[model samples]
Target: MQHQPDFSPAADRNKQPILDMLLRVLAPQGSALEIASGTGQHAAWFAAGLPGWAWQPTEVQPEALASILAWTRSQGLANVRPPMLLDVASPDSWPADAQFDLVYCANLIHIAPWPVCAALMRASARLLAARGKLITYGPYLESDIATSEGNIAFDASLKQRNPAWGLRALDEVAQEAASAGLRLAGRHALPANNLLLVWERAEH
Candidate 1:
């Protein structure tokens, strides 16, 4: 018998940068809920990096769950919780009973429909603690900045694959966040023309 874990070259390349930024932005004491934990690579890597951070990984696709488990086992990370089944498009699929200090979703919006984008914002808001943050990473169309040539091509490819799947405008995403009782906390320019938009749960 042979064992092979799912692989993603892009995830491999960007995980380090994302983890580095997370280290700088987050406190050492916080829990994380990772949505769309494809291949489980990021959760494994990040949990190991932020040893104090408890990480719960989730995915909508059943096929991806195996990979996540494989990576987590390989990393021997004690802080990582078992992966959960979560579909952002379906409100019932989200863990209504759970809350965390961080909601991390990467490369999910551009591939999902617009409604899922709104759903994601609302779901993140619901899952966050008072000062918890929802951090999304992906290429986005910015009203102020010119879209990079690579991102432009990537966006076209995504839309061609599925009319509803394409890079979302930053303003639109921000608006949805606001509607979800989340406010823009910070934005970081990442490599490959991607952006990490951080939204914090509004303080009552």
Candidate 2:
């Protein structure tokens, strides 16, 4: 029997909303590099939504490559390139001399080690074009905003699974971005307490 690609119900639910935001923020044509293209569902959905944009989906796990490829093929997405293995913590894992107009990462930082946040910021800053934007989507804690009960539970559960893993504070994440020469440009509130943030070169 042929192997089937893994599916995320969350991915399916959020893909359209995410694409809607993408259409608003991005230009008509450009190159996009997805940092953690898990399951390739968002890659396929966004590629289809933004027909003129060239999308390259990447994963850190070798096992995930198959699922990404399967999803891309199933969708017949010509705009999406083959998914590549990219470990944000390892600079050696990134594609050298490559630049993209958009670096997209969603729901990744919280699950990974905290160091990964700084690594991601550094990598995104280096890979993005002069006018490029780095868009990250996930639940984040904010000093000014009260934490939702659901998010509190979710954060606790994440930390329970791995002490280093939990919802990150927006302020700290912004500081990391600043240290990497990137700045928070926009913040949009989406469903499920998630925030879609846009980061751009500080000097740009």
Question: Per-prediction RMSD in angstroms?
Answer: 1.2, 0.9
Q: Please provide TM-scores, in order, for all candidate models, with all chains considered together.
A: 0.97, 0.98
Q: Write the per-residue lDDT of candidate 1 for residues 1-204, one digit (tens) a residue.
A: 323679899999999999999998899979999999999989999999999899999999988888899899888889999899999999998886988999999999999999988999998888888889999999999999999999999999998999999999999998988898988888999899988888997674
Candidate 2 lowest-lDDT run of ten: 1-10
lDDT of 2 by residue, 12-90 (tens): 9999999999999899999999988999899989999999999999998899999988888888889999999999999
- Alpha carbon lDDT of each predicted model: 0.91, 0.94
Candidate of highest TM-score: 2
* Model 1 spans > 4 angstroms off: 1-3
Error of 2 at 85 (Å): 0.6
TM-score of structure candidate 2: 0.98
Q: Which residue window of length 10 is worst by lDDT in model 1?
A: 1-10
**Which prediction has the highest lDDT against the true structure?**
2
